[model samples]
Structure formats: C-alpha cells, structure tokens
Target: MQTTNNTVLITGGSTGIGLAIAEVLIKAGNEVIICGRRESKLLEAKQKFPQLHTRVCDVAQKSAREELYQWATSEFPHINMLFNNAGIQKEIDFLTGASGLYDEESEIETNLVATIHLSALFIPHFLQQQKECAVANVTSGLAFIPLKIVPVYCATKAGLHSFSISLRSQLAKTNVRVFEIAPPIVKTELHREAQARKQSQRGIAAPAVAEATIRALKNNHYETIIGEANVLKGASRIAPKFFHNLLNKVATG
Candidate 1:
C-alpha cells in the first residue's frame, strides 16, 4: 500500500493510538478523517491537528457505524483506507457473575462487531476503486494469549484476529488488502480502569504502535505484531500453558 496521498478514516481518533495514527498519516501527506464518541475530545484533536476531519460517532452502535460509513464515503469519496482502531478495555471479574458484564459499552460490539460491520460496508467500495485500498484492524497481543482480568476485551480481540485472517484470504485476489496490527499493552487511556485499580500502567508509547502500523502498511505486512506482543504470539504457539500461566501470574502479581 502506498503510504502517502491516500484518504484514510480512523475510528476512535480523538485520543491514544488512533490520534497517534492520525498524526503520522497526516504528516505523511494522507488526508485523515477521525471519529469518536465525545465531541469535546474530537474538538481537542481538531485543535491539535487542524487538518484532521473530525466526527463524533460511537462505533459501538450499529446505527452509528452505518452513519459513519455513509458520511465518510459520501464526504470523502476518495477514502481508500479504513482503520478500525477504536476500542475499550474493561476488567471484569467473573466471580461477580453477570454484574461485571453490565457496562454501557459492550467490548464485543465496539472492538469486534464494529470492525466486521465497517469492513463489510467499505470492502465493496474499495474493490471498485481503481487503486489499491486497505483495511487495518487494530487487535491486541492479548488476542493471542488470554488475560484473565479483562476477559471480554481479550475475547473480542481474539475474534477480531480470526476475522482479519479470514477477511485477508477472501480479499487476496481483490484490490483490497486486509491488515491486522497487534500491539502489546501500550500506555494509553484504554488502561484508565486498570490505573484506577492501582495497577501498573507502564508499557510502550502509543507512537511506537502508530509507527509500527505505518511501517506495516507501507511494507504490506498482513500481520504486524508489535513489541512484546511478538513474544505472546510465539509463546502461545510454542508453549501455550507455560506462557499462559506466566502471563496471568505477572498480571496478578
């Protein structure tokens, strides 16, 4: 995929990894449009980078997803790249049963379902474009190895990883390219809940993930595993039980 001169739409672009990506893409000369749930956050992002086209839409809702797609494609008809980067992470203790699952945002809806729906909406448009187009799904290293505390978040990413693989195979012969970007725990607001619980929030910077993602796009790497995520992916395949225990141990410790 050509890195420059492409129109891109990134979901959850108001902050964190999404904003970092928008920054990189804009600097690289791509027209970037970003959407998020909060209008104030979008305004802040717009103030920081005046070039970004900002919209407020929650990707967790099916109607919002459809509206975003229609608006993006209609307003920016040249948009060829879609980055499903909007996501939320929550720590749910199953010991509490159904009470832990009653959140305003569903991890399955925002992280997995939104990606599937947006990809389905844009793939046909991308196929009809004369140039190469791409869809990059921002999954997590947790997708490979389950993190016990955030069960739902990990499950959604795992589902997304599987979907990206299938989507890539399906689009292999077409003009659309499917990419999966898996980053290890990054220092982003996604860890707000964990931070509130006094958990360590140390990890790679969001820019590292953003830079890795651009490199993956430029090099056409279908699956780009960033940082310690590579270890999780390798260990999951090589020594599943040991690493699984090691991972949860570190988290609980």
Candidate 2:
C-alpha cells in the first residue's frame, strides 16, 4: 500500500502510540483524523498538530462507534485507511472472583469488540472504492503469550490477532488489505496500572512502533511484529511452554 496521499482515521489518537502514528502519517502527507474519549487530550493533540482533524468518540460504545463512522465518512469521503488503535489495559486478578472484573470500561469491549465493529463498518465503503484501502489493527505481543497480570487485555489482543488473520484471508481477493501490528511493551500511559505495582515498564519509544508501521504499510507486510514482540511471536510457535512460564515469571517478579 502507498503510504501517502490517503485519508486515514485512527481511533484513540490523542496520545501514546496512536499519537505517534498520527504524527508520522501527517508528516507523510496523509490527511489524518483522530478520535478519543477525552476532549482535553483531543484538544492537546490538536494544539500540537494543528493539521489533525480531531473528534471525541469513545470506541467502546456502540452509538459512538456508529456516529464516528457516519461523521468521518461523510466528512472525508476519500478515507482509505482505518487504524484500530484505541485500547485500554487493566491488571485484574481473577483469583479475587468477579469483583475485579466489574469495571466501568471493559478491555474486551474496547480492545477487541470495537476493532471488529469498526472494521465491519468501514469495509463496505472500502470495497466500493476504486482505489486501494487498508485496515490495520493494533494488537500486542501479549496476544501470543499471555501475561498473567493482565489476563483480559491479553485475551482481547489474542482475539484481535485471530480476527486479523481471518479477515486478511477473506479480503485477499479484494482491494482491501488487512494488516496486524503487534508491538512489544512501549513507554506509554497504557502501562500505568502495572507501573503502580512497580513492574518494569522499560521498552521501546512509541515512535519506533510508528516508524515500523510506516515501513510495514509501504512494504505490504500484513503481520508486522516489532522489537521483543518478534521474539514472543517466534517463541509462541517454537517453545510455547518455556516462554509462557518465563514471561509470566518475569512479569510477576
């Protein structure tokens, strides 16, 4: 897929990895629109990149997702790319029973369900276009190897990975290309809960992931796994048990 001259919509574009991607795409000469739940962050991001079109939409809500699709497509009819980057992570201990699972925002809904729904909403529009289009899903290294502390988040990412594979195969005969980007731990606000528990959060910078994304898109790489994520992906297939134990051991230690 060509990297420039395309209009793109990115969910959760206010900060971190999403913001990094927005910066790269904008610099690459693509018209980028970003939506997030927080108005303050959206304003902040807009202030930084005045060219970015900002919208406040919570992807976890069905109504908001529908509204976002309508508003974006209506506003930018030439939109050819969708980045399902909005996600939330939580550290839940299922051993404490259902108490730990009852949160106002669900990881499954935000990370997995929203991505699937957004893809479904945009695909038909993409199919009708004469030009090429793409849907890039932001998954995690944990999708391949479960992290004991963030079980739900890991599961959601795993589901997303599976969905991306199936979606890519189904769309193979079409102009729409499905890409999966799996990045390892990065220095971002997503790891706040784990950081509060004093877990090591040292990882690559967000721009590294963004740069990898650009390279992947330009090279037509469907599954782009960055940094330590490459190791996790390989280990998951080659030595699942050993890596699973080692990963959780280090995460819990």
Candidate 3:
C-alpha cells in the first residue's frame, strides 16, 4: 500500500492500538478517519490530532454499521483502506459456572461480527475504485493459542483470523490486498482493563505493535506478527501444552 495519497478508516480509533496506528499512518501522510462509540473520545482524539476525521459509530449495532458504511462511501469515496481494528475483550471465568446466559456478546459482536460486516460493506466500494486497496484485520496472538479465561475473546479473534484467510483467497484476483495483523499482548488500556477484571497477563507497548504493523504494510507482509506474538504463535504449534499452561497460570494467579 502506498504510504500517502490514500484515505484510511479505522474502527475503535479513539484509544489503544487503534489510535497508535492512526497516528502512525496519518503522520506518514494518509488522510485518516477514526470511529468509536464514544463522542467524547472522538472529540478528545480530534483535539490530540487536529487532522484526524472523527465519526461516532457503535459498531456493535447493525444500524450504526450501516450508517458508517453509507457515510464513508458518501464522504470519503476515495478511501482505499479499511482497518478492522475495533474490538472488545473480556475475562470470563468459565469454571465459576458462567453460563450461556452471560453477556459476553460484546466481545463476539465488536471483534468478530463487526469485522465481517465492515468487510462486506466496504469491499464493494473498494472494488469499484481504480486504485489498489487493502483490508487490514487486527487479530491477536491468542487466536493461535486460546486463553481459557477469556474464551469468547480468544474465540472471536480465532474466527477473525480464519475469516481473513478466506477473504484473502476469495479476493486474490482483486486489487485489495487482505492483511492480517496478529498482535502480541500490548501495553494499553485494553490490558489495563483486563488486568482490572483479573483476566489477561501483562504485555508489550501499543507503539511497538503499531510500528511493526506500519513496517509490514510498507513491505507488503500479508500476515504480520510482532515480538512475543511470533513466539506464541510458533509455540502453539510446537509447545501447545507448555504455552497454554503458562498463560493459564497468569489468568489463575
């Protein structure tokens, strides 16, 4: 993907890795549009980066997704990139008899459903464009190795990883390059909240993930993994038991 002369839209761009990626790409000279559920966060992001274009959209809701799709097409017809980066992670103790009635839907909705819907919504518009376009899905290292505590979150990321694979193959003849970014646990508010909920283990910084992602984009690396995430993905193949047990310790501790 060219570093400049393109308009990019990122979901959950108000904070954490999304914001970091937005900052990185925008600084590289692309017109960036970031959407979040909170108006205040969008306002805050606008204040922090005055060049940022903000939109208020709760992707968990179908109507909001439709509105966002329509608005993006009408407002930024030249958008060549869609970053399915917005996601929610929650720690649920399945052992405590957390039943099916529990509301763990946010993780599935925001992380998986939104990605599918957004991809479907934007692909046609991208295909209509004359320029080379791309879709970057922000998956997790956990997609390869599931953490039992956050079963739903891990499951969603895994599903997303699978979706991106099929989407890429299906669009192989198109100009849009499907990219998957598998991040290691990053030091961000997402981890802070997981820690507060007694869910996830400690992780690396968001800037590191963002920097690695930008480099991968520049080099056209389709499936990109950073730091320990690469180790985890490999360990899940060769040392599944060891990796699973190690992560279980962090959740149970």
lDDT of candidates 1 onward, in order: 0.92, 0.94, 0.88
Comparing 2 and 3 by lDDT, which wins? 2
The candidates, ranked best first by lDDT, are 2, 1, 3
Better of 1 and 3 by TM-score: 1
* Residue 87 displacement (Å), model 1: 0.6
Once fitted onto the true fold, the runs of candidate 2 whose alpha carbons sit more than 4 angstroms away are 198-200
Please give the clash total of every predicted structure, in order: 0, 0, 1
Question: Which numbered prediction scores highest in lDDT against the true structure?
Answer: 2
Pairs that collide in candidate 1 are none
Model 1, 32-80: lDDT tens digits are 9999999999999999999999999999999998999899989999899
Candidate 3 local lDDT, 1-253, one digit each (tens): 6767789999999999999999999899999999998899999999999999999999988999999999998999999999999987777777767564247448878999999999999999999999999999999998988888678889999999899999999999998999999998777766765667555455777888888888888888999987777887998889899889997786667
The order by descending TM-score is 2, 1, 3
Per-residue C-alpha lDDT of model 2 across residues 109-205, encoded as one tens digit per residue:
8999999999999999999988999999999999999998889999999999999999999999999999999999988889887777666467888
Tell me, what's the RMSD of every candidate?
A: 1.1, 1.0, 2.0
Candidate 3 regions exceeding 4 Å error are: 96-105, 197-202
TM-score against native, each model = 0.97, 0.98, 0.93
Q: List the residue pairs that clash in candidate 2.
A: none
What value of lDDT does candidate 3 attain over all alpha carbons? 0.88
lDDT of 1: 0.92
